[model samples]
Target: MNETELASYWNNNAPAWIELSRAGYDIYRDYLNTPAFFTILPDVKGLKGIDIGCGEGHNTRLLATKGAIVDAIDISSLFIESAIKMEKEYPLGIRYTVASATKLPFNNDSFDFATSFMCLMDLPDQEQAVSEAYRVLKPGGFFQFSIEHPCFKTPYQRKVENAQGDIAFEVGNYFKSANGTIEEWIFGDAPDELKNRLPKFRIPNFHRTLSWWINTLISVGFSIELLHEPYPDEEAVLNKPKLKAAREISYFLQVRCRK
Candidate 1:
């Protein structure tokens, strides 16, 4: 699908997404990913930053709370609209915009930092997005981002007991460049009547190899700073036994690159 179609798909899912995120029901972002991301994120106090693909703006709010002046952008108009309304309630100095990640609307060297949390792989034009991220950052600026681990998050991935009876993540089609895999986000807090009436919360994702990501950023003049494969922390696994799978096999990779 084209960029416009992809943006519309996110627009359609925005309402449910905003509700889920605000309620703190988004397990991945709320419970796991955000904490993991902050562990590696550098101090951003007083830094000018842009959060590419900011979605409903939970992370953007977090950035503002951490003292970064943020301009958060997403391709979906509905998502940006919801985020703007949220800004009124909290009154953080965050500017929300509806714009494509691949073609960021910003001046060169305008930001001290750039970020994309679990967003890069979902874009059709990841190369362009990475380039734009590189372009918008000032010299010595850092871009920090995360994505589903390329080695583990395959097109049709699974987990099973190995010969050793230990849980093994079975990966598939890691080398293929592909897209349109459905990512479902169920809003458990929704009313029963609304559940039946509303459509499934589905979004498309693109998959690429680990090397592709590193090379793309390098080609765009980013020097790799940190590579993190974040697993469930001890507290997380203690709270949720199923999180052991993540401890054994990393579900996401966070990286910091300097431009």
Candidate 2:
């Protein structure tokens, strides 16, 4: 899909995004609370930070609470509206804007730090977004990002099957590069009985090798500082058996870089 189409797609699903987040908050809590995510910036007490693709401004609020001057931006007007509502309900003093990641409405070296969570892969022009991130961040400023692991979460992989009436996951190709047309699923809040009744919506998400991400960061003049593949906490593992197995293998990758 083109840029306009991609924006519209996410805008249409904004309500679903909010519902899914509320329903599966714990599934994401660990990753969001990981040391790699929140502990990296020791001097953010008074620094300027920007959260690109800041859906609903959750992480943006976190940064503000840490004493950073936070600016949040997203392409979806619906998301920006939700974020503004959140700001009004629980003021974080964060600035919100409806803008594209590839063309940030900020000046050079405008922020001391920038972050994008689970957003880069979904963008149509990732390279341009990377460049924009680099442009807005001050020298020595950090730009951290998190995304679905290309290796394990790509379209060719991720499957479910019924084996002798018992539901089991059927793994698919992992090493293969993401090419040609593919269907990307977006999960939402739905009871198990109603899951199948819900439509399978598709989005265009590009999968890139880890090396590709490293090179892209370098090309944008950012040096990679840390890379993490987070595992579920022990409590979560014990409570969710299937997820325990998946966590043993891992699913998402988070990276921190400096401009």
Candidate 3:
């Protein structure tokens, strides 16, 4: 799907998906419990922050609770509305706006910190987003983000159990170029009858190597401060046997960079 189609799809579906499943809240909670999240964002008190691609404003609320003046933006109007409603109840003083990540509406040097969670890969014009991040952040401000681990988490792979009942995962083309194609599944809480009603959309998602990400940050006038490959916690391992096994092999990368 094109950018407009993608935006429309998310705008139409995000409210129900987030409210019904509380996926956004759960994700934010998981981030809070992870070592990578705390380590990447130490001492955020009283800072001016912006969360680009802030879906339901979970991270923005978290930042505000930590004393940051947060402005959260998303392309989806439905998402912004839901976030705004939540903000009213929570009263974190978070400002919600409907804006594109690639074309942020903020002025240059307007923020002391910026964050994007699980959003960079989904963007069709990630270069523009990176540039806008660099433009908005003040010199020496931090721009941190987390994305799916490109090396081992391709969409084609699925978990399986061996004869001994040990969980195992099978993945292909670890060294595939960033432009490699893979099928993605968009599963949520839609009813079985409505499942087929929703279209399966296909779009390009670039998978950059670790070095490529570092170089891109450097080219955008930013320097990498931390890079983490976070593993699932012990409890998650016990409950999610397959994910637990995947954690042993390292499955996610979190990056912190300074502009």
Candidate 4:
């Protein structure tokens, strides 16, 4: 699919996504990926930052809470509207706009830092998005982003339960690159009571290899600073058993690169 088509899919999925994610249903993000992402994130106090694919501005607000001047953008207008509504109510001084990450609206050297939380995989042109981030960041600025682990979360993934009810995750298509593939599902960790009442989110996933991501950043003039594979700890697994798979194999990958 084209960028416009990808945006249209996100627009359709935005309401359900915002509602569920705000209600604490996105457990992988809340319990595993996001916490680890912030653990390694550098201080952003008094810095100017842009959050690409801000998604109702959750992580963007976190940046604001850390004393950064944050401007956020998402291609889905509905998502941007919800983010703006929350910003107005909370008064975090964040600027939320509807824009694509592949073609950012900012000029060169516009930001001290940039971020995208669990969003790069959903973008149509991953290379261009990374390039835009590199373009907007000033020298010595960094862009930190997280996404599902490319090796583990592929186009073909299956959860198999044995007779003992032990779950095993199977992944294939690691070498394959998908343009835009529709993946219709709700947050797996959400309580059954709430999940039964909500419609599944229709997310358009674009899959690329881990090497592709690394090479793209390097090609865009970003020096790789850190690579993190976030998995749940034992305490987290005890609290959320659904995350046990992540303990065995990482669920998310976070990268920090300097321009």
Candidate 5:
């Protein structure tokens, strides 16, 4: 899909996403992605940063609370609108815009740093987004991003149960790159019945290999500073019970690079 088509896809799903995250993080983000990303997040006190694909501005607010002057943008106008409404109710000094991740509307070297939280993989043209991220940061600035681990987040998955009923996850299509929409998305905090009744949240996502991601960053003249493939901590496993597969295998990968 082209940019407008892609934007429409997310725009259509924004309300449901807002509902899912109205109170706080739904379980998937709260447990899986958030921990991994924040573990590698740099101190941004008194800094200027831009969050690409800042969906509904949750993480943008978090950055503001951490003392970063944040300019956040998203492709979906609905998401941007929701974020604006949120800012009015509880101000955190974040400026939200409706913009594409591949093409930010900021001037060159406009920010001290750049960030993308699990957004690059969803973008149809990830290279352009990385290039734009490189363009917006001042020399020596960093771009930190998180993604669904390409090597581990499989398109086809199955659970294998042992004789004692212990379960393990098996996966397929790890190397095949594809784009398609899931029939629906299930938030961790939502009741299964409620999820079934809602329209399927549709968006296109591209899957690429780990090599492709690292090579793209280097090709865009960014030096890798840190990389992390985060798994659930023990306490999370004990509390959540069903997330043991996440503990054994990585679900999210973080990459921080400097221009």
Candidate 6:
């Protein structure tokens, strides 16, 4: 699918995503992935930043709270609308725009740093998105991003429960790259009462190998600085037992690179 078609899928997903995520149904993100991203993130005090593919601006608001002047963009106008509404109510001083990551609407060297939270894997053209991020960053600026771990979250993934009731993931297709593959599912941790009522979010899965991501960043003039594989901790598993699977296999990958 093209970028326009992909945006529609996310636009459709925006309402449920905003509701469920705000209600704390996206446990892995709120509990593990995002916390890990911020744990390793360098201080952004007084820095200018852009958050590409910033869904509903939750993480973008977090960046703003960290003392960064932030510009956040999402391809889906609906997502941008929700983000802008929150910005208006909360007044975080974030500039939210409806734009594509592949074609950033900004001048060269426009930001001190950049970020994308669990978004690159959904873009149709990952390389161009990375290049646009490079184009917008000032000298020595770093771009930090997080995505579903390619090695573990692949085109073929199955939940395996052993006789002992231990949950594990059986994943394959690491060598395969999926473009705009429609994945229909709701957050596993969502309350069963609410899950039955909620529409399954239709997300476009664009899968690429670990090497492809690293090489693409390097090709776009970003020097690899830090690589992180984040999984939920024991305390998190206690709150949400489904997160135990993440402890067994990596669920998210965070990368930081310099321009």
Candidate number of the best TM-score: 6
lDDT, candidate 1, at 121: 84
Candidate 1 vs candidate 5, TM-score winner? 5
State candidate 2's TM-score. Answer: 0.85
Full-model lDDT for every candidate:
0.86, 0.75, 0.72, 0.90, 0.84, 0.93
Off by over 4 Å in 5: 23-25, 163-165, 180-183
Q: What are the clash counts of all predictions, listed in order?
A: 0, 0, 0, 0, 0, 0
Best by lDDT: 6
Query: In lDDT terms, how accurate is model 3?
Result: 0.72
TM-score of every model versus the real structure: 0.91, 0.85, 0.82, 0.96, 0.93, 0.98
The deviation in Å at residue 89 for candidate 4 is 0.6
Worst 10 residues of 2 by lDDT: 25-34
Error of 3 at 215 (Å): 1.7
Candidate 6 lowest-lDDT run of ten: 231-240
Where model 3 places Cα greater than 4 Å from the true spot, the runs are 23-35, 174-204, 239-242
Q: Per-residue alpha-carbon lDDT of model 6 for 152-251, expressed as tens digits?
A: 9999999889899798888888898998889999998888988888799999899999999999999888999999999777888898887888888899
Ranking by lDDT: 6, 4, 1, 5, 2, 3
List ranges where model 4 is wrong by over 4 Å: none
- Flag the better candidate by TM-score, 4 or 5: 4
Any runs in candidate 2 off by more than 4 Å, and if so which? 24-26, 29-36, 39-43, 159-190, 193-201, 239-242
- For model 2, which pairs clash? none
**Which window of ten consecutive residues has the lowest lDDT sum in model 3?**
24-33
lDDT of 4 by residue, 3-99 (tens): 7888888888888788889988788888888899989999999999999999888888988999999999999999999999999899989999899
Off by over 4 Å in 1: 161-166, 185-198
lDDT of 1 by residue, 75-187 (tens): 99998898899899879999999999988889999999999998888889899999999999999999999998998898878778768757877788999877767777575
